[model samples]
Target: MHDAGDAVSLLRDGVVLLGFGLVFVLLFRRLGLGATLGYLVAGAVVGPHVLGLVGDAESKIGVAELGITLLLFIVGLELNPSRLWRMKQEIFGLGLLQVVLCGIAISAVVLFATHSSVAAALALGLPLALSSTAQVLPMLQSAGRMRTPFGERAFSILLFQDLSIVPLITIVAVMSRNPADANGPPGWLLFIYTVLAVGGLIVAGRFILRPLFRIIGNMGEREMFVFAGLFTVIASAAIMEALGLSTALGAFVAGVMLADSPYRHELEADVEPFRSILLGLFFLAIGMMLDLHAIAERPLFVAGMALALIATKALIIFGIGMAFRMPWRGALALGLLLSQGGEFGFVLFAQAQNALLIKPEAASLFGAIITLSMATTPFLMTITRRIRAQPVDSSDREGPVADGANALIVGYGRFGQTVAQMLIAQGIPVTLIDTDIEMIDVASGFGAKVYYGDGTRLDLLRQAGAAEAELIMFCTDGDQLSAELIDGVHESFPKAAIFVRAFDRRSLLKLKDAHVDGVVREVMESAVKMARLAMKSIGIDDSEINRSEEHYRARDKERLKAQYETGDLRAARDRIITQDARPDTGLGGGGK
Candidate 1:
């Protein structure tokens, strides 16, 4: 789709790539590795240097790079402006330290190891300082640690690394030995241009995006929203590309502007599929670009530099984490988690090659180093599990895991909001999921985070961390809870207590066979409370009021049990006064 293909060649490439990606991903996942590595291995096997099944990795990468932009946009949605500002210390302090120290140290290593000039070393080394955001984020999410203190810190560092790409590119350009490169804008001018571009994006997002979403949401067309979502991301990225800036950053800034939008989840859901496919393709292209012949010629040099890059970055980052007061275990884990060479290394290396600061052979060699280093991450992190598996204790010897969002609330309407707030007030971590984009927008305006999805689905719940959640509360506004759904959820996540908001006595009776901890009628208690208040307002004595309230509750309970037992509507029909009241429809009050 990146460009028009006239022959069967395009179809052939698609079949080959997707087919191979699917098989390898399944195989690797079954083997306890990861999809990223599988994609890489698949691409390598099919690349020109290997089976020669695919060529033109460069054009593929040009199209696939949109994946990186989309990735950053999603990452941006994870943090609102306030949260991002709060983490300024970590992003700027710890992150800046990590990139600069790792860059300098790796450059020195390259200079000594390769006997390269300072320019060549810097061109190669700085890119190695960056870690793979695409690789690390999913691992953290799958582990249910993406919202933890540790996860936030990791996210902050990655964010800064992304922002640093502009400067790294500028640095490479400044050191260019090619006469052609001399005509490009100088470093300072580029910096000013970057600032102007970012400012322009911020202004546009503030003035343009919300209104556009408002219109799209008003249209109430989900398909239209999908189109709008992609348009937003692509348009922002395109502007950055026009300015020769980080297209990913432009998408990110746009995301931050809408972080608190009620449509955040909808946008995320719409964009995620594209992000995954493109990101996979991006990895595949990186694999195809790897010059195995170049690496095969100097395997020792490539392997040694890979090891050295990982070690230097890991140690430097570990020290920096400790300086930021992270415990040794957390620090060590963080270091290893981010030690891999990033996708941007290829971009920067290409820049280096273009500038004549490094030869094409050098670029290919370092690209292999990055790929090799990336391959080691899953293994290293898998090993770090033992160090972090233990729950933190009073002694503080263990690195604490991400433990927030232990409760998943399935609605955010009026009823669901009260339930969530009460639980949150009690210090329970709650994840709010809703399907109503309008309601989500209102909640977001009040600074509440609500994800968009059909929470009844087991797969969606699992993605939201229902496996570890202590409670699964169904506060949806109707008889949306079914016995089968409840039973499925209970079976799927046995550890979590299940609760549902019953629409009426009939609904409660329907759930008698379901595995649930509790069920409450939507308006039963509030109706009773209103009755008590009405009695008091009419000057009824306290004892009489209490007696009347208890009698009504007792009779209602008795009727409910009788109807549930007999499975007949008439079972409790005679229990209620029929003089003035209409028939009970066995439905909720239809409250918003």
Candidate 2:
């Protein structure tokens, strides 16, 4: 371990990996290609097969495995039981269908070509069935589609795939077990043991985990808390390995158990850096493992196999989407998004090779094909976006909202829709204006009164009768656009009362400066409501909770106004703190 040559090699590998990774990531991003592809290219260039800068890709396997575990752990942290239940249809219905159908179809092809045993065919095909969650989710998020219908469907399918890995690992382990060893446990016994191990994990998570976290949290040492979180993940994984189950399953369960904890956010922040770096290393390892020699020998065969895999997956996914009644455009986009083989394929294939489920030669060829397919995903997604793009219709000039509406709503997005719905239910007439023509079209289809026009444009505002409206509400997502609208309306139509939706404290303060009649911080009220629930959970009385909330809200409002007026944030904060500390103050008690 202390050898100088070993240290030198390690240093050299690190240097080449990080150096090439940085350059490739920046370059690929500028060229509109994704980072995962960049990592692969970087690894390929500096690998032993190419430049010999980094020796023995196998040496990094253990580190790469940890990256996969951490990635699943983070995924589990983002999901809770309730959220899982909400998407049960997509997860169980569409997700299960996709895996089964794709696996069967691919396995049939593999069997026909190689005449392999069913188990071996399945071992190869199942991995191919899974799509890249790591790549697809981030791409959707960056494109502002994470909350769209297509994005939600893609996420549900991905979540199911992630969960499906546990069972796949168990199957591989079972298949790998030697039948000749009579001393080894029987199949039935092994199955019972697996069930027992899972039950034990559930019990431990429910009874033991929360209290342990509570004790750690009370210490007030952030580093200690971080250590505890890491320890929980690693130790859980170790226990699962000891019990002959997958480490990933254990990590996922532990993450879900802590998902509802107050410390969830802190734990996420603590583990994110480790997860990112390790995940990068995992991708790098895959790149280094690329068999350039195999590719060079049969480039045509490899290219054809890659294309077939993509086309097969894309066609199956598109068919599934159509069956589920998704719009053709959305279905096509989803197909392209999920056509690539997942990062999990590498892990599964390696495990299969070790288990003798497939020959090493076949595994190498398949691995190369998977890597090539992954590299094509970003480009395919760009094409899918083009196909899904909608043209704006500007021919409709009729006022969908009543011509004499009392309220003018800027931006008919999610927030604006909710506000408009509540007002409409109460018989309040509202005229909506938004820059997104697609959103306007969708809203109009739902019988909403929406106009396709930019709120920041004074000409459009006048056309929408903003001057005659009793109140102009700014519910647009963009702070700059909302600010511009606020200033324009205040200057041009002084009689119109202005209300705004602000994303954060800065936006709130800026809106106050613009002299809006009302400003609602996006999450402030919801946060207070959550705080009330927390207080109630801790046995605080209902009346006490209400009184405390009211007093705190009033004081906070006064303090915010003072902070804005005097422009002395520190002094204002200090005064509020001092006042709240006084026993005579109503805020210091449940009630006067």
Candidate 3:
């Protein structure tokens, strides 16, 4: 009876917490502030310091920290050996420099300013060197630059940063001030454990995890994958916990082991929801745990520290990017994009507090500074848009040549495959571009080379030789194109005739003002063909079928024109004909 009562209480508490989270998250998202901030705000409002609607923040955080574990797992899944090797130069070279330099620089600043011990400065500053991957990746994706060179470079740094968390944890553990940590394994022994553990995970991934997933997949029981995914993460974390190691590291190892598996995406999809919810919960708990009074007492300290952190990291990163031969604008953009403190700072702050290297009040003050730094990113990018938008000097580099490819197809999906094949069937020189990593791998297996990048960007288009190509086909799905973009392409490459694949009427209407050579509705022709088949099965004569299709084609064209003119899909609804022109058209006009 007590257990049942406790369950009911838990449910009610969940409802209230989620209700607060949803409201604030939606509000913040609408205002262009990220969901992380929203969760923090909600948690603070409902916390003991404010409305006191919730309590036991420390207990809540212990559970919510699983979100961090799950997040690490997903990050590991992204680092497949092949992808890692492909971006090795950027990931290792530039990424290593960014983390090391920024970490050292920030540590020195913390050491000198706060007069903290070397260990304490490292615990605080190393984490600050990392940027918010969660915030930055979505921004890149939304801008359709996720596969661009600049975006990829940014991602490389972020990936290394995520990878750095493990060693950072080890460092924190090494500097533990708690007597409780004294009984733990020594540093060298811990390194051995790390190696043996990683090897075991890889072996498990190849034998145990893969076979289990395959069996579940073959059974077509998708729900089981979710169960299995959670089991894998929890089991790995449990293994580490039993060994008195970092549980998050265990989950990360599990993820990396499965990164190259066929079921990577499925596992990610299954586990993403739980990760998101728990992560939100984690932030909420952090918010509740935040020492508002500490921040209030040291407002000047908070503001000054935030500014110093952002400026120091940005300047350091900008120099590294330039040293790596990035264009000035690209380097500047990279700096600004990654200038903010990340969520992991909070995680490390807790670690520092636990290690007894930093007081809880110091952690809270730094946490507030990190949060403030995060809030400034969106505004900073908005202000520096023009400076980063400047064209790179062509004389500093050799220009991209089309290599005599007459047609450049922007997408290499099903639609693109057909178009490219038809063009190739006619013996036309062709180049294919795409953003889907899995699709690119599959296409490569079939001996088709698909260059990976967002095809919608004018800069990427130019880099792909859009200026020299005779035809540029945008066969990408959905409404990713715009008149302004089309005009830019046209203005840049006068010789290239542009053709676009419109997903629907709305997309077509949106592109109505663009001076493109052609626009093909993706499903219109196939839908018309199927409709004709239906008419033919019902015994309509060839002439009647032709007339019906022609009528629909004509009416649709007229309706589309009207709708496009008025900028409304509902403008020409009356033009749809319910009654046919054929009088008493009988089935087969007399049974064949």
Candidate 4:
């Protein structure tokens, strides 16, 4: 039986994670590295194999799994099926070929070096077939590359990796020692099982989960909702495992099915904390699994192998990216981002150990190598940033210029595209300024007068016709830049009507304070539609509903002003939404 002191020690273990996490975050910031790398390095320090600060906890694996689940779930939320179909050439065509070529090439090299069977070589190769979706996406998002062409290409590749894992793992499972590896489950039987599991999941995910969630939501219990989220993951995983498939694959499929659900955001919000904690725990467990004692004794061998792994993978990716017509800097970033082995490699290695396909010592060595590779990513990204910031040739800046039209759209992102296309269809003269080179090319192909330039710079805006323009629309995501553009426009072109898209009420208030003529709330538009629907259902005339909505909108403006002054508009927004739902609430009664 465990002693009371053991219980106390266990209680203290959680505290150590907090202390280590903070020091790591601060030190990484001081070192000019991102906080994510710090968190990973901190896990290494606190792991049982390192400083012995905290021993491995099996429950932490669940935490890490949760992290991956939430990470992929959020990714699914961002993806639009229509957008994916449009990018199928790069995603399926280019991406599929890259995975096949890379996997085969890497497997051959690894098999030759290790004298491993084809199964073992293929298992090892599969890990490198995937790039780090988590690392790449966040880096692109931070560098404002998420809206760029390179970003879209990277996303397509990442999506392919996500989908490929299912087939790759299935192959691995088949190749690895089943009691009858020569005569495994019949192909037809396996196919039928996979089909049935996937179909049932889709049916349940669509019809059953929605009604279940709606019932739970009506109960208004936050904890219950969180429980339901967990239930979904566990239940899906169980069904998949019963059919001899991966739990990760099951979780991913469940997420894809729920991607269009209204409750997705709520589900994500509810699950994120659990996911983060688990992923951290997963990293910590990885740290504990590393054989640091062996590394200390064989530092030269470990270092050499790490260098070779990184160098070879980098060269392959860089070469392929260049061949695909990626600009030098973009190729450099892609190569660096993918140079390392990922957590998935560790997962595959562990499975190989269970199958007795790889020696335990060999698995340990591979695991350490995989961990080291993941740890090196942030360092590489930091270096890549420096490379990107280097001076470029003037001749390389060749691109078509935006026409000096009466109206200028300073951004060509999703929201900007919608507004721009509508205006163009009406024959209103418009020019677009966007920093994304790919977006500029795409928009120009569709007959838009678009140029690549940093819109935040007033000089660029002036050159793009902001001064002579009848109107300037700010539809970008950058809060500070959008606000700055509004201020800049007021100073330079006081006669031009400045319209800006607001991410939320706070931003709208900020724009209003800047005396902007028009501000569109992203969520407010959706909320108004919902309000109109509810009112119509309750026997309110369409004309009266429109008037009521307008009155509420005016009331909301005043309320937002007060809330903004108080600097707690989130709470105020909630209150306002609640009040808007009540018939007796004192905003207004009828049509405009």
Top lDDT prediction, candidate number: 3
Q: Write the per-residue lDDT of candidate 4 for residues 469-567, one digit (tens) a residue.
A: 888888887565445557877898876788888887667656655757888876688888998999889887887786777767777877877776875
Q: List runs of model 2 lying over 4 Å from the truth.
A: 112-117, 177-184, 260-263, 390-402, 406-408, 414-429, 435-448, 453-592
Model 4 misplaced stretches (Cα beyond 4 Å): 1-6, 25-39, 56-83, 178-191, 218-220, 242-244, 319-329, 375-592
User: What's the true lDDT of residue 6 in model 1?
Assistant: 38
lDDT tens string, model 2, 1-592? Answer: 5699888878888988999999998897777566777787888888867887886778786777787787777777877768888888998988998888887787776677668898898888888889887778878888887876677899989988988887887777677733432345766887887678667777787788778878878888888887988887888788878765678888887788778777778888888888888888877887887778877888887787778888988999999999999878778888888998887888788778767788766777778888789889888877666577654545554433338888888878888988888988999888888777556666778887677766777777777787788888889895664456578788987878988888777676666557678888887888899989999998888988888787777778788878788766553664353444543455334233
Output the better candidate (2/3) by lDDT.
3
List clash counts for every candidate, in order.
Answer: 1, 0, 0, 4
**Model 3 ranges off by over 4 Å:** 1-9, 391-504, 507-519, 522-568, 571-592
Error of 1 at 172 (Å): 2.8
User: lDDT: which is higher, 2 or 4?
Assistant: 2
Colliding pairs, model 3? none
Candidate with the larger lDDT of 3 and 4: 3
> Once all C-alphas are superposed, what RMSD does model 1 give against the true structure?
13.0
Per-prediction RMSD in angstroms? 13.0, 7.0, 7.9, 7.0
- Score each candidate by Cα lDDT: 0.83, 0.79, 0.88, 0.71
* Pairs with backbone N, CA or C atoms under 3 Å apart (clashes), candidate 2: none
